[model samples]
Target chain A: MKARILVSFKDSVLDPQGQTVRNALHTLGYDAVQDVRQGKVFELDLSGISKAEAERLIPEIAGKVLANMVIEKYTWQILED
Target chain B: MKARILVSFKDSVLDPQGQTVRNALHTLGYDAVQDVRQGKVFELDLSGISKAEAERLIPEIAGKVLANMVIEKYTWQILED
Candidate 1:
């Protein structure tokens, strides 16, 4: 089994890194870019675990280790392949 | 229009950050986790641009600014919503 976890800052939080990227894009002539939010993606391989076990563990892992729940939110999907 | 850009290190690259996270997961008792890869995701909002223009510009933006082509690869998708 494989899983993907996306960890991103909540909309309410300020993202200076994102702002910096947006500014760089503007300077690079991509003026049409209105906003940019940067996030993290974690791809996990779980060949030893069952799908049900993976489903149950992924969110726990994402929250406890991969994300800072106070400022970031995480979503995850189990991969079929 | 909106688009998503995913930037990740190529398989040949050494991802110490990912290895660190995997170690953390192991410490947290997710022993089934075999491997982990970390990447970046950029969510972009482009209300003033047409879909065609966005398609043309996104890759240019991603390749030239968002990713280091020598070590990382990027993929993008246009969002309908």
Candidate 2:
């Protein structure tokens, strides 16, 4: 089994990195860009685990280790292997 | 239009951050985790662009600004608004 996880700042939290990127885009003349949000992606290879175990572990791993619940949120999906 | 870009280190590149995370997960007893790779995600809201223009610009933006072509590779998809 395999899983992909996305960890991003909560909507209410300020993202200075994203703002910086947006400003860079503006400077590059990509004027159509209105907003930008930056996030992290984790690709996990759960090669020896069963699908059920992987499903159970993914959320726990994502929440407990991959994300800071106060300012960041995580979403994950099991990928077909 | 909206575009989501993913910038990841090429397979040949070393991902020290991901390795550190994997070590943490291992310490937490997730032995099933065989490998981990970390990447970046950028969600861009292209409010005023037409689909054709967005298609043309996404690659340009991703390649030139969002990713270091020498070590990182990027992929992107346009989303319906």
What DockQ do you compute for every candidate structure? 0.89, 0.91
Report, in order, each candidate's fnat: 0.93, 0.94
- The model with the greatest TM-score is 2
Judged by DockQ cut-offs, the docking class of candidate 2 is high
- Model 1 regions more than 4 Å off: none
Which portions of model 2 miss their true places by more than 4 Å?
A: none
Model 2 Cα lDDT, one tens digit per residue, B1-81: 779898999999999999999999999999999899999999999977689889999999999999999999999999776
The TM-score of predicted model 1 comes to 0.96
Candidate 1 lDDT score at position A54: 86
lDDT of 1 by residue, A1-81 (tens): 789898999999998999999999888888999999999999998877778888889999998889999999998999775
Candidate 1 contains a number of clashing pairs equal to 0
Residue A29, model 2, lDDT: 91
Clashing pairs in 1: none
lDDT of each: 0.91, 0.92
lDDT of 1 by residue, B1-81 (tens): 789898999999999999999898889888999899999999998877778888899999999999999999998999774
TM-score of the first chain in candidate 2 relative to the native first chain: 0.94
